[model samples]
Target: SLEVPFPSSREAVIALRSLSPDREPRKGGISKQLTVSGSTLSWSADEARILRVSVNSFLDHLSLVLETMEMFGSPVSQ
Candidate 1:
């Protein structure tokens, strides 16, 4: 399990939703899970080469989400 902390719970939830859609392309032999509690995103996966690739891809998407959040402010408009 890996826990990634966000500045706010809202951001954590946003990240969770953004990252949740892309399920692993293959079935069986590999698994990935993502969830958010408070201001932290929790991730777990099966240990394998695919895990590294999946995590690297997730990190890439995560960075983009965080950067967009930084630039545009909160996702919710007042």
Candidate 2:
């Protein structure tokens, strides 16, 4: 488990995964909705770090793209 991130929701995901590798675990998804400030916020966290890692990766990619655009120019659309 140490091969992954520290004590986090992701660790829980991995724990569940390890317990049921052949099939999906029946645990409820993490997160809840709140209505406040005349608005609604639906925040959630997965037991797996997959979503967090993906978000990080997305930010990294965006940063790289911005840096590249600053250094070079906009990429040509395909």
- Please provide, for model 1 over 1-78, each residue's C-alpha lDDT reduced to its tens digit, 9 standing for 90 to 100: 678999888889988998888766566653767889899998877665555776777788889988989998776844
Per-model clash counts, in order, read 0, 2
Off by over 4 Å in 2: 1-50, 74-78
Error of 2 at 7 (Å): 40
Judging by TM-score against the true structure, name the best candidate: 1
Give the worst 10-residue stretch by lDDT in candidate 1. 23-32
Residue 34 of model 2 has an lDDT of: 16
Residues 1-78, model 2: lDDT tens digits: 012222334333433333233332335752321111222222224334544544554446435534554577433444
How do the predictions measure up, each by TM-score?
Answer: 0.80, 0.28
Compared with the true structure, model 1 gives a TM-score of 0.80
**Candidate 1 error regions (>4 Å):** 48-50
Best by lDDT: 1
